[model samples]
Target: MMLIVTGYMYVEPSSITEFVEDLQKLAITARQRDGNLSYDAAMDDPHAGRLLIAERWRDQAALTAHLHSSDTVAFVGRWGDAMRGEILKYDARRERGLMDE
Candidate 1:
């Protein structure tokens, strides 16, 4: 099963640029991981300092590897104070898509 990880983050206005840069690095590292399926980040259009991250992994093990990686620790360190909310995870199964048709 794919693991879906979503995060709703609020960054300090001053750290927004740095936070984004950090996310880009993390994304690069995630893509190189064996279990990574997809990792995307986007900012909220209407809300300043608000951002969202969505990730899909091949399985729990892959996601676990990502969470335990040094990149993840560094990413967290860079954004720890800027983070406002919780990171959420869910087990996902694709229910409908072009392939399903």
Candidate 2:
């Protein structure tokens, strides 16, 4: 099954710019990884210090591999202290066309 992960990061106001730069680099690397379907990050409009990330993977195995990737590990170790966040993941089971319903 495909996996979809989404979340928000609450960063220190002073660190927001740096966080964004790092996140962009991470996203680029993630997109080039095997089984990575998509990776994106955006600043929340109503929240000054909040950034949102959404990712899609081919399957649980792919997601697991991503979690263990060196880039991912380094990113966490490097910027973990600059932000706080939660991630939620879901398995996609079915899809239907709008006209089907």
Candidate 3:
């Protein structure tokens, strides 16, 4: 099974640039982790202080590894105070046809 994570972060207006730089670093590190399918971040067009992140992993084990990875830990330690957000995860399965839906 695949895992998908999506969320929005509310950054301090004055810290948006710093937050984006940190997010880019985090995304780069995360993409290099084993079983990482994708990691992406984007700014919300209509919302000045909001940034969105989406992540995909191969499985629960992979996601767990990422959660405990040093990169993630260091990112949190370095930039945690500059933003606030919620991330939600979901188990994903591919559907081949409408009949299967």
Q: Name the top lDDT candidate.
A: 2
> What TM-score does candidate 3 get on C-alpha atoms?
0.85
Q: Which candidate number would show the highest TM-score if scored against the true structure? A: 2
The TM-score, computed over Cα atoms with residue i paired to residue i, of candidate 1 is 0.84
lDDT of 1 by residue, 1-101 (tens): 88888987788777777878888888988898998989998887324678887888999989888888988987777667667755799988764676766
> Each candidate: RMSD to true structure?
2.2, 1.8, 2.6
TM-score of each: 0.84, 0.89, 0.85
TM-score of structure candidate 2: 0.89
Per-model C-alpha lDDT, please?
0.82, 0.86, 0.84
Once fitted onto the true fold, the runs of candidate 2 whose alpha carbons sit more than 4 angstroms away are: 45-47, 96-100
How many clashing residue pairs, candidate 3?
0
Error of 3 at 19 (Å): 1.1
> Candidate 1: global Cα-lDDT?
0.82
In candidate 3, what are the lDDT values of residues 1-101, reduced to their tens digit?
A: 99999998787777788878887987888899889999998898424678788999999999999889888888888778876888899988882576775
List residue ranges in candidate 1 displaced over 4 A: 45-47, 98-101
